[model samples]
Target: MSAPENREAFVRPPALELRGVTKRFGAGASAGRGARALDGVDLVLGEREFLVVLGPTGAGKTTLLRTIAGLETPDAGSVALHGRDARALAPADRDVALVFQNFSLYPSATVRENLAFPLAAPARRLSRAEIDERVAWAAKLLHVERLLDRPAKKLSGGEMQRVAIGRAIVRRPKLFLMDEPLTNLDAKLREELRVELRELARELETPVVWVTHDQAEALTMADRVALLVDGRIVQTGTPEDVYARPNSPLAARELGTPPMNLFDVERKDERWITADGVELARADAGAPERATIGVRPEHVLLDGGPSDAVVHVVEDWGPSRVLFAHVGAHALHVLAPRDCALRAGDRFRPTFDVRRVVVWPRA
Candidate 1:
């Protein structure tokens, strides 16, 4: 290699990079052609960062991860890893590990055997002692040391997922690509694994690109979130930033539990008013004539305040209660404390903290 080439190679690049990435499927102009999975995606992942890719079905979350892992080639654009072009690199050569939603383990093999496979590969040529050490460490880290000798086929969904994750971590890859690894487990197990995975990522200091459709998981686990919609990145920011202050009403609706409550406010007499004639805050100077206001369920207050709505249904979630209310013709979802004395068919007033409300120009 030339001196300049060597110098360029030595310069640390982003852990993962995609420039103008585009991927489509099936026929180009068929009547029922396959959809475009990714559209001109430009993303950079920094070292030791946890970036969660969030979106609905067909939003291209899995496609982005596959492109990074070299499982799918882009129709256009470039992929680079650690300052090197990765377009030609095979999946194994990319120094990236992928953990799938299905816990894709060797079913016939023992947990220990599954964990050792990556380290014992012919290309790696690791000594048995080294491979054993790696397997032991991974098993211990994942709290699966007791189950190391158990067959993968006999384990529960959560246990198999832990083993699958152990296999990926045993190799100590430069990047981790996780595609809904916790989706298969029950809610309690999913929460347990989620916390463990976050700690493990921090301990290893490895860059990770996690793909999921769960809003709570994305908000809790991501250092930063990249929300993909219609094969494009609609927004990328910290969880609080994205939830509290969204660039668009669509982004706000996508992140919340029951989604944000959106209402079109009209500018009448220089005052913002809802359709129900409820008075909202004053309009901003540069704000358009009409704007959509988004308020989250947590921010929506349903106490002894103004009365523009009635309690439709109260859902008890143990520690929290979700009130589905009717404000005029609009349905409002509000999150409240479990001890609140509200129930079905009860009348109540819904107001929100103006500071927490998000306003977007109506289109």
Candidate 2:
């Protein structure tokens, strides 16, 4: 027989771990009692994991990163970085790098100086050759080798953003925290950098926690996504898993553009009855007695037997079309092909595969 495996030997500790992390701002009557920036937030970043924190505006995504970077102290909870308590450490002592949305480059410095600043500090005390080597490596990695001599203030938004990333790369931190780094760039530049960032994450072998409100960005770049709502983590899973199966109504509302249409239904004998008394096929046995039926816009099909609603509007996109329809009192959105002949005031029926439907229990 082969040698017995050592489970302990194979076990690797998390790169970053948070337990019951809570942070509040202000107190008493002067500051409106108090406001909680983060409440009982707990998360763990596995070794070499690229975790994206996704949420809407005012979801405390930035606060979470500030807490981990030691910029904001938690009112309660512990932050363990590489198995060491990091709460008492200063921002620099934490050995973490943060890339902000607005590229925080020094206006007076050249691209080379900004990239060299982290290594030039007295604590690091690196030799001239070592610092030069690191600076050159970062410049090449970010495709900013030609801009090294250019003043930071003179560079375009995209160029400055790359330099900001280069600054972090030279530090070589254990954890990388990016707060909407691509938000300021144009659409094309955002897409280009997104691919580069994903590749860099793999080559560096460092844990990264990226914060963004863009669904497309999260779906494309994340190995796993942590969905936050009102300062709390509502769900965490792979992009494919969360998109295909949302656990709650709140999740369905947040994931898509038009979002998942939820229809409240009542079970009547073996059939399900809509609010307007339209009877549909019965849900499978063992489903909740009272639940909401959810289906995506793209899944709604128009070629069916009955006309349940009238098309209110049609949005043409060359390749496909989006139909806005009124079904009883509820408004529904359907994604249709460019060949769709339905127009305004046209009656149509919406249908979809049973397996594609997501059921959310009401009771």
Candidate 3:
């Protein structure tokens, strides 16, 4: 390669990179006796990227953030920050900001002081004017400028969260780490902040590694998502890609709302049959005799079909209906239009969108 090309290639690196990172708790981390919080996880985040680590509770989402922030040390593998090994950097030296679900702030101080606290760190050399300017900028960006003079104790939950996030942004760190920061807010506030935070991250052009168990946040805000399960990195892809083309049943279960309905079935000739000998759908000629298949709620069409289904319950969503039903022996969820006149004890023939069905080897 030419010298200029070499130089260009050398200059650009991922904002954050993790390779075979492993962390454990309890006894000595290296003894292999402790519970592993992170295990052989690999991920890469591009410059100014928004990556959400989506997982269930106890999936080591919090541990992943702490390891990135230098608050926790991994027992194995490497963490690279902007191409440099992070083994030697202290938490403060890594130039990263962390925001948590619980609003961590100085309750007695005004919002201005809370936002400015990070800049006042002993390690930072910012002058008073610089700190104040950044505080104003962060507060304005978070739409909490009006609450600057209010005591932290006086702010509502949403305001306090904005301030917590403002405190992180005021320092202008290279990366932002958020651990379910909106989980504590009411539904309306959480919805509002999700959009706001996404815009803020783009406006700042700062890379973020936000972790959450909420699939909604991952789907709505992420440029890409990393599925973490049992301390392992299961899958990484754009929200749409991961949602539509999950690599495994475990991966399929992580993203969907009302979750994907999975079934274990046996392939019989050209058909897939459920446990009780009821035909479910068509099976690929080359497919395994027994495997697991997944169908999302919306894919279960109820207009008219071959199989009989009895609606056990109906939930009226604002614009649609969710029917909990039994199709033969399979308990299923079907999404129907709000106008559909279906109630409990109603019966319909349910057909599935076979093209969208996902199949995996039975485990």
**Number of the predicted model whose lDDT against the real structure is largest:** 3
Q: Please, what are the lDDT tens digits per residue for candidate 3 over residues 1-363?
A: 599999987789999999999999998756876999999999999999999999999999999999999999989989999999998899989999999766568999999989988999988988999998999899889999899999999988998998999999999899999999998889999999999999999999999999999899999999999999999999999999899889888998887876788888999997888888878777889988889999998898885566788999999877889999988988889888888888999999887798998889784
lDDT on C-alpha atoms for all candidate structures: 0.86, 0.86, 0.91
**Ranked candidates (lDDT, high to low):** 3, 1, 2
TM-score of each: 0.90, 0.93, 0.94
Residue lDDT tens for model 2, 1-363: 333356543665689999999887766523434687788899999989999999998889999999999999888899999889999898989999999876579999999999999999889999999999999999999899999999999999989988998898787999999999998899999999999999998999989999999998889999998888888888889998778787887777778766777788776765556767765444777777788888888888885623387899999977899898877777788889999999999997777556788888786
Off by over 4 Å in 2: 1-9, 26-33, 280-282, 305-307
Q: What lDDT does model 2 reach? A: 0.86
RMSD of each: 3.7, 2.4, 2.1
Query: Considering only N, C-alpha and C atoms within 3 Å, which residue pairs clash in candidate 1?
Result: none
* lDDT, residue 56, model 2: 96
Q: For model 1, how does the per-residue alpha-carbon lDDT over 1-363 read when each residue is reduced to its tens digit?
A: 599898876776999989988888877623434678899898889889999999997899888999999999988889999879999999889999999776579999999999999888789989999999999999999999999999899998888999999988999999999999988789999999999999999999999999999888899999999888878888899988888888897787778877788889876764667776876455566667788988888887775444567787899988899999887777789999888898898887776777687788886
